[model samples]
Every structure is written in C-alpha cells, then in structure tokens.
Target: MGEEIGSDHFTQDDFREFGERLARETTLIRKLQDEGGLSDVGPVIGLELEAWLIDHNFFPAPHNQSFLARLGSEMVVAELSRFNIEINTPVEEIAGEGLARMHASISETMRQCASNAHDDVDTVIAIGTLPTLRETDMSLEMMTPSNRYAALNREAMRSRGGAPIVFDIDCCTGAGEDFTTSYQDVMAEAATTSLQLHLQLAADRMRAAYNASLLLSAPLVAISANSPLLFGKPLWHETRIPVFEQALAQPSPHQRVTFGSGYASLDLVEIFEENLELYPVMLPVCADAPDSDFKCLKLHNGTLWRWVRPLVGKSSDGKPHIRIEQRVMPAGPSVLDMMANAAFYFGVVEELAEYIDAATAEVPFEAARANFYAAARHGLGAEIEWFGKNRRRSVVSVLDDLLPMAERGLRRQGMAEHLIDKYLSTIAMRLASKQNGAAWQLAHLERHGDVHRLTADYLAHQKSGLPVHEWAI
Candidate 1:
C-alpha cells in the first residue's frame, strides 16, 4: 500500500482484467511453492515507522505536503492523513550490529525529518495514538492528497453500501471512569499510526515464521501497548487495535484489517489464495508489468491489512521472495523503544519457530486470535493462554518466561551478544516495571495531569531518547 498508484478511478474492464491477471499470478505462486522455486534470500529485516506531524501546541498539523517536499527524501513520505508521514529504513542483515544499525538509521531519519519539518509543522512524533487528537480533526479535509487514499476511501465507503463508518468503543481505565463513544468516517483510521516491522524469510520457513508471529502477537501487543487514550477517553491499553479496525469497518469479513480469520495450514501462498477468493479488488488499476511482478495480487493483498501480513517482494536480482510484515506494535514513544520491540519480536519468533510442532498441536488458532485482543484491551495486565498450561497467564509472566528463550534464539542466530543484551534487556526492564507506553500514559493521567499536559510530557520523553518504561510521570 506504500507504493503510488496512477489513478483513482477504474472502469469495470479494469476489474475484469485485474481478476484475470490475479488468477494467473495466484496459479504461478502455487506452482512456485510446489516446485520450491521461491527465493531463499533472507532473514533480512526492515522497519517502517509511521508518525504524526504535530504543531507546537501538540495538535495534528496537516502540513505533510510541504513537510515531505521540504525533506525531499524518498525515505520519508506522506501517509493516509497529512498529519502523518512514514519513515522507512533500508533492509539490514540479521547479524552483528543489525539491531543497533536499525536504531541508528531510524534516529538519523528522525533528525532529517526534524531538520526539514516546515514552519507549519512542529515535530514528527511516533506514538500509537496521539492524546491531543480530536474527533473534529478526523475529517476528509485532513486526508493526504493522494489518488490511492481517495480511491480507498471511496471503495471502503462503497463496500459499506454508503453507510457511515462507525467507531463505537467502550473503555475502562481503573484510574479514569469508563467511557463509550461512537464516531463516523474513515478519517478516524488516520488517528492511529503504527511501527510495522518486516522480516524476509525463506519460502520453506514462511509457514513456521508466520504461525509463530501469530502466536506471539498477544504478548507482543501487551508489552508494547502504547495507544491507551483516543479522543481523550481511556480506551483499551492499545486502543488503536479496535480504533483502526472500526474506522474502516465494512459489512463483509474480507474488507476488514484483521488478525486473520484462521491460521495458515499450508505455506504463505495460502494467504494469497484466500485473498483471491474472499476480497473484492479494491484498487484494480490495470498494470503494465511482467507475469513475475504479480502487481494485481500485490495490490489486492495490500488491501487486506492482516496483523501479520504475507508479502511477495523482488530481490535485487529480480527474483521473488517472501516477507512476514509484523503490524502489531505502535510507532513511538522512542526510537530505541521501537528497536527493542523489533528485537524482542525477531528473537522470540526465532526461538518460538523451533516449537511450531508442539505449538500447532497444543495451541488452537482461535485461542491465539483471542489472546491478541485480550492483550490489546489489557496490556501487560492481560492474561493470555500459553502452550503448556491450559489456564491463562498474565502477559508479564509470558514475557518473563520467554526472555531467556529470546536471548538464546538471538545467540543461535549469530547476533552479537552485546547488541542482544542491549535490546532484550529493555524488554526485560519493561516487563519488570510493567510500564510500557500505555502504562506510562495512564500513570500520568492518574497523576491528575490533563490530556494536553500528558501529550506534552510524552513528546518531551520521546525527544529525550529514553524508553517509555524509564520515563517519569
């Protein structure tokens, strides 16, 4: 979905042609899978951190048009809303200093973005959901000026048969009184931004990697929970979980950005098969690419925003490869925090993949999916089901038990011990303190600070280059 499209409008002929091409590509994918023809290029990792352009007052500043232009860098680009822009880092090999390199690259990009943040936009922030964001700010007028975004809004609205997009959520924060409110429009989706991590794996390992990612989603979201407040209401610990889904809600299952309907029984190609079967082509632009490109399949797959998305990419040599894009974590509180989150994911998923045989037998797909939502709703405070015990365990307990496994996984993968300890130790401290981004924000709110003050404090902590767990209220 990050790639640019040529046009917003498509003819019926376009859909038909796209469908024909998609079917051919899907078949090609299956043949490749059966023949073991997919690229064995990586365990290479990549990062995409989407952030907000805020004014000095901390309100979202719709100036990404000028801001991106001023940056004049391909690494930084506009998002669904003008107030948001995405910062991308080049893929780094998962070896010595790879995690540290990821952090350094992101920091450099942040500096570049800050250097070019036009006068109208104050600074770029990478947080789950901005506390100062108002319902009034979520209007069509705030959307980034792009054909793809316009077309997406149109198709999504059309999918709902022109019914208003509704965001009805009930939230209970122990410190604050529970609140429930409903919103209307796709712009609300713009309010939630995330830090998406991509790990390219060999085709043979795609299923194991994908399944492990799904199983780890709950504890991942719990420890990394950041979007606690939305529109000044204390919602779920990671409120963006529900907010983003409901903002783009449709009557059909295929159109929703989901945790997936079920686990993958086969290889990664099964995901594209499901996409071809269930999702109606939302952006059926006629493409002029080779059969190997699979533009039609790629575009359609992009529309289905699964938490852990299976993607097909071309290597430098133009051969096709597979990547598992992890979409569970939110963007900020800080760059080090984001890298720690990614390190924890890569390490745990690596270690957990070894247990896929046991996990598949012991853990049900439905339980894995439910655990994700439970964690998003309750953060580290959430209880999730693990493989050995039928009973649910606190997310904190889950992370504590898995920390050593992650360290061992990183070591086994040949990651530098210093880098491993530097990153995973942060996750360890977060588990010990039980104060992730969401917890920090909730604590501040409990200290009698208003949302505005909280946002300012968050930005200050974020700018200080300190992890959220160490940030004082």
Candidate 2:
C-alpha cells in the first residue's frame, strides 16, 4: 500500500501524505463494491514469475546483474539477491483457452533462459526455498545492488530497534549469524530457491480473492514446499514461511508469532488500509515526478498498494485500476506446474466471486484463517474442517473438493473444459503425491543433513527437471 513500484525511503510525514493520497485514489473496483449493479469482473488475468540462478555446481550464482545487462531488462527483472532474476509475463486475460497461451509463453521463457545460461551458468530452478541455501549466501552483501532495496532494508531494520534485519537463515549453526560451529562447516550447503507467481485480478473480486487467497495460500504452500533449510537447521515444510513473513512484516513490537494482533488484516479494509499504513516507500523515483515533493503522510497516501497489497493505478484507457497482488507463490518444476498454480487460484476467484455468501457464511472467515495457518504449519498432514464438527481432512481432501469447484467455476467462465481438466488436475496430482517442492526438499535435507550436501542433491534433481514424486521414487 505504501508504494507500488518500489522505494528508497520514507519520512515521518510521508505516512500522513500517503494516507491522504489513498482517499483521493478512485479505483475501478471501488465503483463495483460500492455501487453494486454492473462491474467489470472482466475475465482478466496476468502473471509475474520470479526465479533464482545457479552455478554449474548448482549453487546460487551472482549473475543477475550481468545477465540483465547482457539480455536486457524488459522481461527479466532483479530480485532480492543479485543471484535471483524475475520475469513478468504480459498481462493475459483468462478468456476461453487463454490460459494455454500464458503456459506457452512461460515455457518459451524457460527455454530462452536455459539457452542464455548455456555455458555461463549451469541452470535455473524454481522452488520456494532452495534446499542448498546457506547462511553465508543470505548476507546483505549479496542483496540486489539497488539503492531501493538497500534503503528499504536499512529503514526497515532501523525501525525495529536496530536489529540486523535478520539476513541469517535458520541453519544448524547455532541459530546465530556469527559463526558458532567449527571452520569445516563454514559455507555449508546453499542452493534452495523458489518461483514466485504474481497474478493480477479485477478490483471487485479483490475482496473475495483476498480471503480465498488465505484459504488457497496453504494449499499452494503445501504443493510448492521447496524451501526446507536455513544453514543446516531443517524446519517447516516451507521454511520460507517464517522467513518471508518476517522479512515483510510491519516490524512492530511483536515479530515472533504472526497469528493475531500483529497484522490487522481481517476483511478488505484492514488489508488495504494497513498495507497503506505500514510499508515505507521502497522505490527510487527518477525524472518522472513533475516535482520532487516531500511529505511523509502525503507520500504514504499517494503511494499505491502493490505486491504485498491491493494496488491502485491507472490503466491504458485512462480508467483507474485496482488489483490484489499475491507474492507468496514460489517458482516451479515446470510451466505446467506454474500454470496449474494459476488455474487453481483462478478457479477459486471464480467460485468465490460467483458465490460469495455460501463461502463466507458456510466457512467462517475465522475458520478459513485457522485452516491457512494449519496448512502452512503442517503441510498435507494437517487436518482441516470439512462439513462440520471439526472433521479432519487431509490436504488432499480439501483440494479434492476445491479442485472440482475450480473446474466448474472455470467452465462457468466459458473456459475450455480440456484446459481446466488438464490444469486443475495438476494441482490435484500435486496434493495427492505429497511430494511437493517443500516435501521433496525436506526429504532431501533429512537424508543429507549437511546444508552443502543437501544443496548439491537439490541441484542434481533440478538439473534433471523431474517432477518431485518422480524424483522421489
């Protein structure tokens, strides 16, 4: 909510200024949510894919800057790490068999990526947490060499009582960034990575997608758990879970547990308002702004809600745009896997938009929230409330019911049946196999507790580009 593109810093007054800006922004979705009758719930869809680069040995490679310079910055963008790269797919409308086209584009991009890295780097694999990730690899030194990232990191850490912005990943190294173990274990293993998927949605459905996102979040995490280690410490199915939340958290007095009062995101208002309230402007503006204005609250109000938020921006036709951007999705096993993730989510949006009352009423928002945390805490093994009486259902059961609903919803949108089946079924298979990225990474780490060894094994599997269950078997 603070800033859409990115930012370098924010002063005390920027908050108040940005807050006022929010009041002035007339987003397209507000028209529908407020007026009710006719709205654009247009079958619009879009995607942003982010991935990490690895060396021939299958470890994080610091090639992002060089690659972007050589290949150009139109498609691939910079990520948190200089070793990481991001691809933004042109916005595609999920009309008819539109999803197929998006899938093909992603495939082509992957091929191009491989071709570009042919001899220079070994490969590029996508997963939530790179199994090979090491504490040394997460240092601020490797952070994307951008003024924006550094500024934001500096300000963010500064706000939280001067804590070291926690660049350390949880490894067996005694949970401290400073070396606690012997010299032999210095580097450990560090190639764990992820593919983050960003989807764009119409504003009216924003609220529905927001809530449903929480419900869908767990399932996606369960399926895409590729991050399972910090240094040598193996924890959580998707170890990225704790790290990501902590990294983006509002940095209040309490950063330990996310549940309850920490984040005031309940209904739409809390989500949007709070996002606008917390995040400091992270982008460095160039010659774009007519004048260099300085106002703390003013900048806060003027900034848009993007990624970690529901954003407001102007569209091609001069109309305002409001979109809910989901940042948690990790990179993939394949384009098919990534598209399936998108499809499953689209189905949820369709179902929720079409039938809001039933979803919200039947499943209390509180229960929905609880289910999400449970799924994240414990992957497929976690139990969920199905019909009634706290009936425990495996992650599979939840997806089984939801996958069909997604398919139906897609069909309702006039999407081709074959496409829906092909895509949604992938999600089903993902849950059934229980060998998602996280699951596979965890198993790999357990087999080879050494971080470096775990990372090497992860690279071996990624080099093969085999499905998790396929690799596991």
Candidate 3:
C-alpha cells in the first residue's frame, strides 16, 4: 500500500471530502455481482464520442450547452469545454458488423445534432485537437459549470499547484533530457476536438478488459495520432493521453504526477489495490447528498485521475455502478474509425478471456508492455515485439498478424464480415499509407507554419467531415 511517502499525510482515503460515496461504490459492486448477475459476462458493446462545436468563423463556440439542450439528453451531453459535446451509442458485436453498427449509430447522432443547428451560429466537427483552441479558451470562465467540474478543477489547481490546461510538449526524442512528461501530457490532450469512444464491460471482466486497454494504448494512440502540435510544435501522434493526464492531475504540491504503477496486472483487483495506494480521489461527493457509505478519513483531499480512475455513481434506477471509464481517445476521422478502435480492444479482451491459458501464456507480458511504448512512440510505424511461432515482430507486422486474428475473433462472435472489414481495413490503411492524424497534422504545420492558420484549416477539414485519408490538404 502507498502508505504516505516519508512523513507525508496523504492516504487513499485522504482524497474524500465525504466517505459515503466510497461506501456506495463498494456496496454496489457487491450487490450488482451477487443479485444482478452483472458478473455473468457477455459483451455489452457501446461507445461515447466527444466532439467540439465551432461557429462559422472557426472560433470555439460556447453555445454547446444550448445546442445540446436543443438536441436533448437522449444522445449527447456537454463536455468541460464550451466547444465540446459527447455522443454515445450502444455497442454490438456481430461477426464483423461491429464497425458499421458503431459508425451508423454515431453518424446519425451527429447528423441529428447538425440538423438542429441554426444558421445564426453553430457547427459540429469531429477532430483530434482543435487547432483554433487558445490558452484563453480553456480558462475557468469558459469551463462548464457543474459541481463535479468545479470541484475537480478546484482540487486539481490546489494539488497540481497551477493551472493545468495551458502547457507544452517535449517528447523523449527531444534535446532536453530533463523534460517533464507533464508538459507533453498537457499539450497532447484533445484540444482541437475528437470523437472519444467508451465501451462497456461486464463487472466480472473489468480487470482483463482494463489491462487490455493499457496493452492497446500504444497502437490505439499511434494509429490515431491526430494531435501532433501543441500550441504549434511537433510532438506525439496522439498527444491527448499525456495532455489529459496532466490537466486532470489534481493540484498537488509536489512533482508526483499520477502514474498508477506502470502497466496494470492481469486483474482489476491489482489496479484497484495500486490505485487505492498511489492515486488519490479528485472529486468528492456532493456535500448535501444523503447517500452515506463511509470509509471515513480526516484529510478530505486527494488527486484527480483523468483516464481510467475508479468512478462511483448512482444509476437511473438509483443503484450504484462501479465501472472504469476509458477517456484517452480523440474524436475521429469518422465514426467507423472510432468503433474499429473499440473492437480492437473489446475483441482482444474477449480473446484473452477465451484463450488466456493458451494465448496469453505464449505472449510475454513485458513484450506487450514494450509493444505499448513502441505504439505510443511509433504508432502504426512501431515495431511491436510479439512472441510468435517464429520470433519477435514489429507492432506493424504483429497487427498485420492480428487483423486476421481480429477477423477470426470477431467472426467467432458472429460479427459481420463487412462490419469487421470496414474498421480493420482502416487500421491497415493507416499503417500502409503511413497517414494518421498526427502525420497529417505535422504535414499541415510544415506547410501552414502558423498555428492560427493550422487551426483554421483543421476547422475547415472537420466541418467537411472527411477522413484524414480522403482530405486533399
């Protein structure tokens, strides 16, 4: 357990302003498992994609709340930024049809919102990071007004000791050896905007599914590296991971940026155990709320975890649901691309479960770890080190190996061929073409040379809703 470093007062429970929420969280997990059959595994596929709204002049539009209100809660919700909104659609795995189903559902959601947008001033664009985003844009004034958001922001400022939104990037390959990951972490975030995808896992399978997310992080990030420039400098393909990590870092006094102990173990208990030790709570339950499930603590302050932190929430029926929210993806080249990414992870988890004794036994967990770094560093260009019947292979080739595995896997699940192909094909095209969102962004910066112009161009492209592959520059 992360018993406070030195004489440090921080403890896992030190994160709470109130303890009832934790009690609710722990209790619900027990009930949901025992009575609800939530632990009885099956793929409950779905996705949540976040997008930013902009006006005709390509400026960030703060009207997203109003726009979303017009659209209603049946499909979307406003994000932290005024310019953003999120769309979620149910997930289904049918022999190869996963991508198409995910795509159609997301697209229709966008189209429905677009149809309602008025000529006076409103448009929605799906992109990795909005180039037009300015330091002033993410200021507290523009932050979405909500208790959770405000509480998170305030706690983040105090724990992090500064504002988290505006920052820079310096990849390991850069000249400065002492560069902090926090800088790149902040810049790599979803500034331009993106289509973030969320997939649900059965309660029992949470541990394996979460570890698979860490395993897929590299490739998922690399292939979709749309965010290259931070305030207009070249960096990682998809900078959102680092950016969000830092921005969401709770306001801590020290340099202890959250890194929940390297890669997660094969089980969720390991993550929870580590998280309970390393990461602190970032958001406290509403003070006046009646829900009282207490794991009492005195300090009442903890750090914020942006990506895969534990969440305690009351569902529509007023039952507690303990689920890990995967929040690192950017908006998309298309809804199909987003879903394909989902299938890659979701399918892989299923693969691990069905064949862990044989398949996972063959693949070195460390190699998978290496593959992750390679993916983050090289993306589709990375050489993943896989334990094959022959020898180790590059991530690119390994994926070349896995597409069929994915196909067979998806097919076994009764997924439609075309659906599987639609997304998997893009993964291949991304590798072969060597054209991902990051590469395209670097190329754009190479020519435009002006951050403002680059952002404007991004706005134009996204408004057109064309995939990075199809765009003509």
lDDT of 3 by residue, 12-126 (tens): 5544543445445445444545576343333445567778777776667877667877777666876766677777776454444555766788878888877767653367777
TM-score against native, each model: 0.97, 0.79, 0.77
What are the lDDT figures for the candidates, one per model?
A: 0.86, 0.56, 0.55
Best by TM-score: 1
Q: Candidate 1 clash total?
A: 1
Clashes of each: 1, 56, 47
- C-alpha-based local distance difference test score of model 3: 0.55
lDDT of 3 at 220: 63
lDDT of 2 by residue, 392-470 (tens): 6676677777777788778877777889888877777777777776666566655655666655665566556445556
User: Between candidates 2 and 3, which one is better according to TM-score?
Assistant: 2
Better of 1 and 3 by TM-score: 1
> Sort by lDDT, best first: what order?
1, 2, 3
Better of 1 and 2 by TM-score: 1
Best model per lDDT:
1
lDDT of 2: 0.56
Candidate 1 structure quality by residue, lDDT tens digits, 35-129: 97788877789999999999988899999999988888888889999899999998888878887888899999998887775679988888999
